[model samples]
Structure formats: structure tokens, C-alpha cells
Target: MAEPQDRAQEREELEEIVRSIGRPDAFVLHEVIRRTGNEELRRHGGALFLSAFAAGLSIALSLIVPGVLKRYLPAADWAEVLVRMGYAVGFLVVVLGRQQLFTENTITPVLPLLHDRTLKAAWRLARLWAIVLAGNILATAAIAAVIAHSGAFPPEIQRAFAEISHQTIAFGFWATVVKAVFAGWIIALMVWILPATGAAATFVILLMTWLVALLGLAHVVAGSVEAFYLVLTGEASLHDYLWRFFLPTLLGNVFGGVALVAALNFGQVAPEVEEKKDADGTG
Candidate 1:
């Protein structure tokens, strides 16, 4: 038999567990921002580069899986939906695997800059951006080379891959820029929603990335693999890849992720930060 005090404590614990059931505890805004910012600051050059390379390699799955699906699925009209679902595969690997994705940096690094507003912070941000972008592109180019020459899949699947790669850069330069902006916006929004998602984070990532694919928006990192594939196969010129897709989409992603999402969110929370500072000073 339990003592009365032990019984009361057990009853309280049971009630607390019942109340907590079916309710996931989401991360608060400031804690999420701080944690991400701190992690970025603490990550060393090698770690950052390798993680980015891994992400680039992994994100290629987005293109590869969809191509495989396109080759096998019957020529039904609705098969496109299944194809789009494949787009989430790489994102799942990148996000859940805790790799460094450049687009994700748009939000995470910006928070630290907002908090500090110093030239050193800006320089750190710039250095991180350059390294991650270079690593991602290098990893992606390697995948493109393999896909073009390694005889990794059936010729029909390779052809489908090439065809899908061409579609990624089919839009005109300005059109791709606009589309990439939307892509950046969606990606940044996904980053914002992630901290609050808890166990449902995978669902959020899949849904957002699928929407990105379904809407035909441009994503710089994932799109890099496709563009490189076209280049490797002689289907697209290096000049066009550089001028049309890579540069334009890169700029658009920066604008969308930084200017639109990070800046606005920071602005919304700026007042609360100031109030807290004032309170601390008085106390």
C-alpha cells in the first residue's frame, strides 16, 4: 500500500500526463532563433563544408527519384502528383539528417545578425554563405557527372532524367528569377514553421517541398543538380546555366528568404526585444 503523500504525488503525476497527452510541445520563437543562430556560429569550416556537400548530394534525390518514378509510372494524367511527392525525398534527407542547406541559412543566420548588427557578424554570414554554396554546387556537379556517364540506371531512366533536367531551366531568365523568389519565400516560410512543428516536422517539410515542385517554383540548390545534369549531357550551355538559372535563381532565393521572410519576422519581434531590454535595465 502506498503512503498518503505518495498516492497524492502519483495522482498529480497521472493528471499531468493525461493533460499533456496528444499535445506536442512546440519550441518558442526566441529559443528556436537563438539555438539555430548559436549553432551556425559555432560550426567550424570543415563541418560546415562537409555538411553542405552532403546536403547537396542528398538533395539530388529530389530530381533522381522523380525521374525514376516518371520512367516507371503508367502514362496516367495523375501520375504527376506521385512525381511531385518524390521532390520531398531530398528535403527529408537534408532537414532530418541535420545537414547544412544554403536556403535554410537564409533564416537561421539572419537572426544572429539581427541580434548583433555588427560588421563581424555580417562577415561571418558572408563567409558561411560562400562556403555552403560552393560546397553544394561541387557536390551536385559530381552527381550530375555520375548520372551522365556512370550507366547508373537504364538508358530510358537516364533519358527521363535528362528530360526532367531540361524542364528545370526551360523558363526564361526573368521568369526563373520570379519563380525562384517564390521558391525562396516558400522555403523560408517552411523554416519559420519548423520550430513549431515538433514531431510533425517531416509532414511540414514534405508538404512545403511538394508544393514547391507542384507550383514549378525554382529552388537554387535542388535546381543546381538538374541544371548541371543538362550541362553534363550537352543539352544546355554553361553560359546559359550560369546566366539564366544559377545566378538569377540565386539572387531570387536570397531576396525571398532574407528580404521577405527574415526581415519581416525580425521586424515583428523587434518591439518585444526592446521592451525586454528596457525591463532588464530597470530591474
Candidate 2:
């Protein structure tokens, strides 16, 4: 039998365990934002481009899996569910691999830019964005070209790709833009939440990206692969890809990532940051 003192200690320990399950403090999350922003600003153009290119290639798996699944599975609602779940794979790889995904840029570097608000910082942000977006598109286009003519993918899988691309384009220009905004917003939020999640970081990535897919939200990089697949297969024109999907989605993602997530989050933490600055100066 435990003594009363031992029972009280056990109760206290249980309370601490429960408390430990809560979210990270604002300061810790702010540090994560600052560190990630600084790191993105610091990466060289060549390295950033290579990582973005790899991310673009990896994101193709999201499209490819849906095709493969549609080829193998019986037609049903569950098939759609499984297909949507597949969308999470590429994001998991990119986020975990620490690749320079463009949508991710909408938030990460922006934080530091917000913190500094310098002309040089803005230029650096723009330069990084241009390099990463160009690399991602170039890589995805190359992959789409190879996939279109490689004779590696089966006829059924190719058919599935066409069907998927058609559905993607069917959403129309403005709709794609709106959906892409949500996609960007969610992805940026994932970056913000990850440091606080600790060991469950991967699960958060999977869930957030899965929500992006399941909701039919367009993601600029992954959607570029879809658009390029259509172009390479001769189903879509370059003009269509550029005007209909790419430009709108890109702008929407930038708006969502920068405005919806980073700016709002900065507003919430600005006071805390100012307080710390004053404290440091006084100390």
C-alpha cells in the first residue's frame, strides 16, 4: 500500500505528463520561424534550385500514385479516398527531405523578411522564389516529357493520368486559384506547426497535405506536374498551361501563404517579439 505522500506525488507526476502533451510555447515556435527563415535566406541559388527540382520530381509521385491506384482498384468512392491519400506521399518526402518547395517559400523566408523589412531582404526573397519556382517547373516539365514518351508507363496508367489531368483542368481558372489559395495556406500552416509537433511532425505533414488533396485544392508545384503531363501528352497547349493553371495558382498560393498564414501569425507574435527586444535592451 502506498503512503499518502507517495499517492500525492504520483498524482502530481500524472498532471505533469498531461501538461507535457500541450502545444509548444510562443517563444519556441517563434524561434523555429526565425531559424527556418534565416536558413532559407542563406541557401545558395544552386543548392536551392537543386532541392526545388528534386521536390518537383518527388511531387510527381502524388499524381502517379492516383493513376496507379485507379488502374488497379475497382471503381468506388473508396478508390477516390485511397487516391487522395496518395497525394500526401510527395509532400511527406519534400517536407521531411527539407527541399525548397515554392509554396513553402510563401511562408519560411517571409518571416525573416517581415522581421527585417529591408530592401535587400526583399530582393533576396524574390531571388530565392524565382530560382526555386523555375527549378521546380523545369524539373517537372522534364519528368512529364519523359513519362509521356518513355513507354515505361502502361496504357492504363497513361489513361488514368489523362483522366486526372482533365479533372484538374475542369475546375476552371478562378476556382483553381481559390483552391490553390487554401492549399498554400494549409501548407504554410504545416510549416508553422511542425516545430511544435515534435515527434508527430510527419503525421501533421501527412494530415495537412492529405487535406489539401482530399479537398481538391490546387498546389502550384504538384499541379504544374499535372498541367505539364497534359501538355506533353498533346492534350493541352502551352498557352493553356500557362494562362489557365500556372499563373493563377502561383499568385493564389503566394497570397495564401504570405497573407493568410505568415502575416497573420506575425501579427499574433509581434507583441511578444517587441517585448523580448525591449527586455534584452534593458537587461
| Model 1 alpha-carbon miss at residue 47, Å | 0.7
How well is each residue in 1-283 modelled by candidate 2, as lDDT tens digits? 5665665675565445434646767655765667567767777789999999999999888888888888888899988898888888888888899888999999989987877778998999999999999999998898888778899899999998888877557677898889889989999999888877867889999899989988988888998888899998999899889878898899889999999999998888888877876888831
Q: Write the per-residue lDDT of candidate 1 for residues 47-70, one digit (tens) a residue.
A: 999999999999999999999999
TM-score per prediction, in order, is: 0.88, 0.89
Worst 10 residues of 1 by lDDT: 18-27
What would you estimate as the lDDT of candidate 1?
Answer: 0.84
The C-alpha stretches of model 1 lying farther than 4 A from their native spots are 1-27, 278-283
Best by the TM-score measure:
2
lDDT score, residue 27, model 1?
A: 25
